[model samples]
Target: MSIRQLFRMGMVTVALLGALPAAATTQLRVDLSQLSRDSDAVIHGVVRRVESRWSGDGRRIVTDVEVEVKEPLKGQPGGTVLVTQPGGQVGDIGQVVHGLASFKTGEEVVIFLRKRGTQAFRLSGQAQGKYQVVREEAGKPAMAVPEPSEALLLDPVTRQPSTVVEKPRTLAELKAAIRAALTEPAP
Candidate 1:
């Protein structure tokens, strides 16, 4: 092949590699109990807005999600709360932090939140800390659905794959569980 042709092919390969989506380097495997223990606040709310922007340091992209609190299972986050998570698109550039929880406007969710400094809160265990609320049937109340990625997890101690079977529960039941967890002594 001509040198010019080889140079063009190399350029195309480099561009294609840059366009590929980022893959998760680490998988989070936290059960409900662990999520509760790690979180400072557990809240059931609807996402009111989502805003993406570059971090103050300009090192990474972050998304700020405003959640209108319907109930506070732990802590005292009244009214609206801002939850920040890593990963977002800014203009032509985009960054995807795999395993990070994402939120959409008007979406209902149950979130286990850990305080970041004094102002922001983040998911305790990435996707494992966020639960989508979905209706079971027409005219039925909504239930919290755990992340599908949690279906299979690697046990930290054993370093072996283990299936995590999550049972659907109503919002009230989930709140109760969080309350119970709050009363228990931390391990």
Candidate 2:
């Protein structure tokens, strides 16, 4: 092949590589008991607003989610909380961290959070900590649905493929499990 043709082919290959998405992140999938035990707060809330911006160092993007607290299941009294998470869009630029949790405005959720500062929190276990509240029909009981994570999940203790099954639970049932997990003696 001509040198010019080889150069053009190389340029096209580099462009395609740049456009490819990053590999999926790996995370340890924690059970509900572990999530309840490790979290500083468990909140049932509606996402009031979401904003993404560059981090303090201007090296990466972070998203701030303002949640209007509907109930405080395992923390102090109900109020607004700002949850900061990694990865988001800043203008025309964007980033997606595959294992991180995401939120939408006006969506109801039950989130497990670790206290970061005054009324500030972070997700307890990446996508495993956020649950979307959904109902099949009007007036029907709502179910807490765990985020459908794209990450390769491993068991925390064994470091092997996670055996934990994620399934939706009624909101009431989820709350009770959290409470029960909290009250159980630590192992």
Candidate 3:
């Protein structure tokens, strides 16, 4: 091939590579201690409402979740709080942001929040900070499980890639861990 033709082919290859979707989002793995220490507030709550709409700039869709606080583990977030996260379905259009927490109405959860504005909050460590509360059966104790994510997580201290297969903990155990973490010095 001529030099000019080779250059044009190279340009096309570069353009195509850039157009491909990202394989996975990457972030540091946040453990329970980090979640407790970094969060402005941590609360166990039930999702009262979930609404998705276009952002003020009209560039993206965001979901606002209203959580009724059942227990405040860290800060005084009051009876209810609004937590917003990027991506959601709005009308017939939708956006999905990988490694972000998703909330559903009436679902029970323990959320680690960071204050954004006067009254709004966001997840402390994105997907790592949200744990769903589940019960196997009626009268059984509930379990708290970290929300699953497709993101690649790196170790915070080592900065090396890490894989975490979290095991579900009882609600009591999770609460205890959070409380214990609260007492330890921040890293």
Best by lDDT: 3
Distance (Å) between predicted and true CA of 72, model 3? 0.4
Residue 60 local lDDT, model 3: 96
lDDT of 1 by residue, 1-187 (tens): 9999999999999999998544444554677877888788889999999999999999999999999999888888878788998889999988987667778899999999999878789888777888899876887777888765523355667755545556778876887888888788987
TM-scores for all candidates? 0.79, 0.84, 0.86
Residue lDDT tens for model 2, 127-148 = 9999999978988899999998
Superposed by TM-score, candidate 1 places the C-alpha of residue 59 at a distance from the truth, in angstroms, of 2.6
Candidate 3 on 123-159: residue-level lDDT in tens? Answer: 9889888999998899889999999887878887887
The lDDT values for all models are 0.82, 0.90, 0.92
TM-score of candidate 2 on Cα atoms, chains taken together: 0.84
Pairs in clash, predicted candidate 1: none
Better of 1 and 2 by lDDT: 2
Clashing pairs in 3: none
Q: Sum up the clashes in candidate 2.
A: 0
Candidates' RMSD to native: 7.2, 6.2, 4.3
In angstroms, the error of model 2 at 134 is 0.3
Q: Residue 35: error of model 2 in Å?
A: 0.4
Please list all clashing residue pairs in model 2, or write none if there are none. none
